[model samples]
Target: MKSYLAPKFIIERDTERCINCKVCVNQCSFDSHYYDADDDKVKSRIGKCVGCHRCVLFCPTQALTVRENPLDYRANYNWSPEVIEDITKQAESGGVVLTGMGNDKSQRIYWDHLLLNASQVTNPSIDPLREPMELTTYLGRKPDKIDIDKQDPQSIKLKTELAPQVKLDVPVMFSAMSYGAVSINVHKSLARAAVEMGTLWNTGEGGLHPDLYKYGNNTIVQVASGRFGVQPSYLNIARVVEIKIGQGAKPGIGGHLPGEKVTAEVSSTRMIPHGTDALSPAPQHDIYSIEDLSQLIHALKEATNYTKPISVKIAAVHNSAAIASGMVRAGADIIVLDGFRGATGAAPKIIRENVGIPIELALASVDTRLRQEGIRNQASLVISGGIRNSGDVIKAIALGADAVNIGTAALVALGCRVCQQCHTGKCAWGICTSDLFLSKRLNPDIGARRAANLLRGWSHEIKDMLGGMGINAIESLRGNRLHLRGIDLTDTELEVLGVRMAGN
Candidate 1:
């Protein structure tokens, strides 16, 4: 069947520099490059290229160049090139269009519109280089009041009982990315980095691998609808246990790890059969209401003997504020909101681009609602999805996020190009694939160092930003939206974000 699709990228090899080394042929996982015995030359079939740039990176002589195919079509804003190509692709495949990573649409990124305030003269900014700046954060419920008994100035006693909390040296955590969805080396890297950075890393419903049990202190075991590998040990081994209700990338749909990506190791870790697709139902069959959710939350706490906090993760949606209120009232110690721009291993193109609300607005609303109801101290708030840098992390904290999670940013440090080819299980960078040959490309030792270095750099930047605001501790910045001002934003956007306009 002669398909009507054109090559997405054009591969141009410099024949004069090409040495016919077959390096491109071996490096390309998409089968775009091939060795032609008839002509004794290295050639490329551009149609199969996914634009991963693996071959281009490995070409010793630097003879290969790949660029967007720039195929012209009738100009119609309503029927844009991408739209027409999507329709054509579906017509030929008769299957849902699948993609990896977050939404690439030109949606309003609130971070760019929001500006941070710095102290001028009255506040007197502190120098982070010479002064002490605290970035330590705790994730868990907090007591409304603490009772104290002062027998003497030096011998005060009688304190309030504190809820179990996970202490983080910094407020940034590595977001959940499952085993089957990515290679085990990536998991090892995350786990090791979390330990070194004194933060936590989530295991995204794929369950924990046996080797990762040693990093339990820095691990967050996830329980999705599938309950792939839920056991008493699994519940007890982690610092925190999170219940995954929804993700920002595909809110209403379930998670799908295709059978081809599921190997023996993944099957063992997730407790599913080898070569079987791991699908988590959209909704937890056991949870119909907030009451049901409370039961499960209590069940997990009971399983862990109340030694750790239980977190509830949900996608940022229209009714997030109301839903978050219920979750706190339902015995949740921590609430995680994954915003619309969150990344994923696989999701339908339609849903990834359309559904869910932005994390900025969602964070502001939820924080405002919680404060209004005086339940803000009952549970900690953590935001995720599209957190790109330390500036975004500090902005999130000012908007009421106790901490932020980074998935795509962490992957980028590990060499992901955001090529969106992860779902095909052919990730040339080896960060997102499970194939033995490709998975080894990511060395856990090097990966761990790179991921940890990212945290270190961001932590330094966060302290600098905080010091510029004349704040020495991160806790003081929490829910302090006064330090944030909006530019090029609507009145409604400013109101929803709980921020004043710039120059106000």
Candidate 2:
């Protein structure tokens, strides 16, 4: 909180050309610009500026410019200019390389290439305004078939149904991020938002904060290798339990929360020693194979009394279909595929960009394989990693996903510039930081509203897309590849996507 070790970049305004239109003031959320009471002139606080360039880009007059301090370190190319600079800054202070949200680089985010379609003039589009659009979706394992006829007419059924459904108001849910990695207030915000929106929020591998148990109905507690804060009581409070296999940002790596960020509250919640690093092992010891995964799943089930759904989240890779199929057979109620391009608080840049397959292909392949094996209904599939907009969500559903989990996009809605500094715990936007003062910049109420608005907007767009496709419900759009056609795809690609050539 004292000072940013790297020399700061400041934005200066040309007062001669500046009108008191308050455009820059309105544009900047960082409170960098303020009106001087005495002179009625706009003043800028250089220390507060994040150099996000929002004000500069939106300024009506070309009156603003940003410049870095002369003492700032010059860019180097040891491991790409960006990586070199990030490393240089972090090394200078000996602090963690903090970042917000997930990996963001031009690494073939598959959603861009795949396109969505609408019905032609010959086909009629449904009027969503006049008719109800079903956005409600259910998560958890689904039954292949129900048999009630075997029961005697007079006999009462004593045993309860095996699996219960966890319904979501929207198809999108918040991704896991632990209390220690973020803040309790941030967790509370997400919890309240999930409750209000009727979605779910993941507890990440950091374990559950006792204060957040009130949102248990909408929470998905995670069990990672280290099992930092996990207990039978903690496991019993969630509607869903996600087993963290690997994250997209650091596929083969584990997470380490330095002692500096693990405050007393975080320590207590995570049940780790205070002033010690919280280390989550790269992989669970019990899960060495598909059979091992089932054992762990059953262990959790036994601990939680089989009440909650268990989700296995893995980074989407080349063999995602086969892995997901194995997960289904491993008693997984839900399978979450985190694409390689997914974001993390802090991860090795090499892993973020170079690892994993795109969600589009992963989702399509998994869905196809599940259906082919006739186990598509055995467990639900949720896709994550780079879903940028509503079109991406719709396309993902069409490619065969029960729902999607959004992390980077949600933070952006809450005012993140994707600066990739979340690991440092000093987010300019305040959404990803633990500093109470800086964190206050994000009013959870307003943040939740903005997040809700984004989801609502996307939902409307999804409905519009579905309407144009002559689909009355979103379920109808799920896995309906007949509504899609492949363009510029090779024979193998076309075959994999289950689409015909453009001309045909």
Candidate 3:
């Protein structure tokens, strides 16, 4: 009952503007809105409000408004209200605090500190409208050298031996979001969009649904520690197989899908018992060292008959550079580096905000290390975490990433309000929920078109940016650090980004 002592959000209803339609009453999932028979008016129970703005968006009368509570609790910098509330909640329930989405704390977003440079008087800028710009990217190991025979001087024959490669029409791919964490509609939408965009979408530790197996040509199947829903048929269908070592949201930790969300469809897809907790151990017990990782990499390759490329994903930690080098040496065709800003279905509030390094620094350092070792061509690099628009994607490529993964941005396109209440399995938007009624809020056909439009529009913007840099092709922007400059940063910070100050 003490939980009602303080309401975080205040829901206000204007009696004059209200039409008594009770739309808010029917729309609110939190049960915050109601009708008082004696008063013959609509009212709000502030204690139950979560400030999602769902009622405000759906209300036609324009009578409802929600705001943060202004109540004070003896403000203290060291013992702030948030701190006190956290303590109280912990004291009340002996459970770890959970949060969804990415870290919300104030941290240095390096992208904001850096700026892109355009052509000057000496160098002329090319117009994308008049040029044939290339956006095609190949994700796989490339041969050190191609051989040609000089035996026949008139007709020289060349030997072509290539490892597995996944061709993309654009340099963006959807990041991991498991079947249990998101609804089947989301998976269907992403699958359709990926096929339309000529890119790929990932199945993050969740087993593939039989209905979605048809999208195998444009899907990347993930094998996480729990091995949920992973079978030989799943491996044989995907164009690429990813071994998930960890993610940025909760590095050094496994994933947890609460039992409440394990519905029949989710249960069938994951091949797990219904109404039971789904847990992925912190580390794959079978993998302990680089050699162990290599064993698994080769084992996956063997399973797919060397027809598909294998990718290894790791969070950007302090030792990410060395770790990436080890992964490349372990025969991984691709390396996915997830930064601190990466999103998740659910994670502990503490770890989500404090445990990983930024992708900018990690990408720059890993690229430099790999180049210095003369093995940069051994594996392709993909980075994710807080990639918002086409500009962010262009900047990431300039910083040494071959591609950027879009997660939160895609969810936003599907109408997510970023309420950060996904862990409760009661998402205001249907993108993150398992409830049949809530899940129906998203139509796969419409969501697919929206996702496709976002990618298509972003691809055009990327080409325009490349053209502004006096380049006609996107490949010229890849790892070309000279095209970027830091605005205001220490020398060390600039060095880590491998970019000079603007005007230098």
For model 3, the local distance difference test gives 0.90
Model 3: which ten-residue window has the lowest total lDDT?
1-10
lDDT per residue as tens, model 3, 1-504: 456247889988887888989988877777888899999888888688877788898889888889989988776889977768777777778778898999877898899988898888889988888888899999999878889877979998777678898999999999999998998889999999999999999998989999999999999999999999888999999999999999999999998899988999899988889999899999999999999999999999999999989999999999999999999999999999999999999999889988999989999999999988888888999999989999889999999999989999998888777778878887766788888877887899999999999999999999888888898877888999999999879999999999999989
Q: All candidates' TM-scores? A: 0.98, 0.84, 0.96
User: 1-504, model 2: which lDDT tens digit per residue?
Assistant: 344354357677898878867777766656778888798887778666666666776678878887765653455545555565666766678655544456677655555556677788988888888888888899888787765543777875634365857999889998888877766666777778788888998988888878788889999999998787888878888899889998877787788787766777778888877878888888887788999999999999888888888899999888989999999999999999998767887776666767787777888899999999999998999999878899889888888899999888887887777756677666655666556555676787788787878888888888888898888888888888777666767788778777666556
Off by over 4 Å in 2: 1-10, 13-80, 83-100, 150-162, 501-503
Question: Per-residue lDDT for 1-504 in model 1, tens only?
Answer: 678888899999999999999999888888999999999999999689888888898999999999999998888889988898889999998989999999999999999998899999888998999999999999999999998978687989768888998899999999999998999999999999999999999998998899999999999999999898789999999999999999999997898899999999999988889999998999999998999999999999899999999999999999999999999999999999999999999999999999999999999999999999999999999999999999999999999999999999999999898999989999999988989899998999999999999999998998899999999999999999999999999999999999999999
Better of 1 and 2 by lDDT: 1
Error of 1 at 314 (Å): 0.2
**Pairing residues by index, what is the TM-score of model 1?**
0.98
lDDT of each: 0.94, 0.80, 0.90
Number of the top TM-score candidate: 1
Candidate 2: what lDDT? 0.80
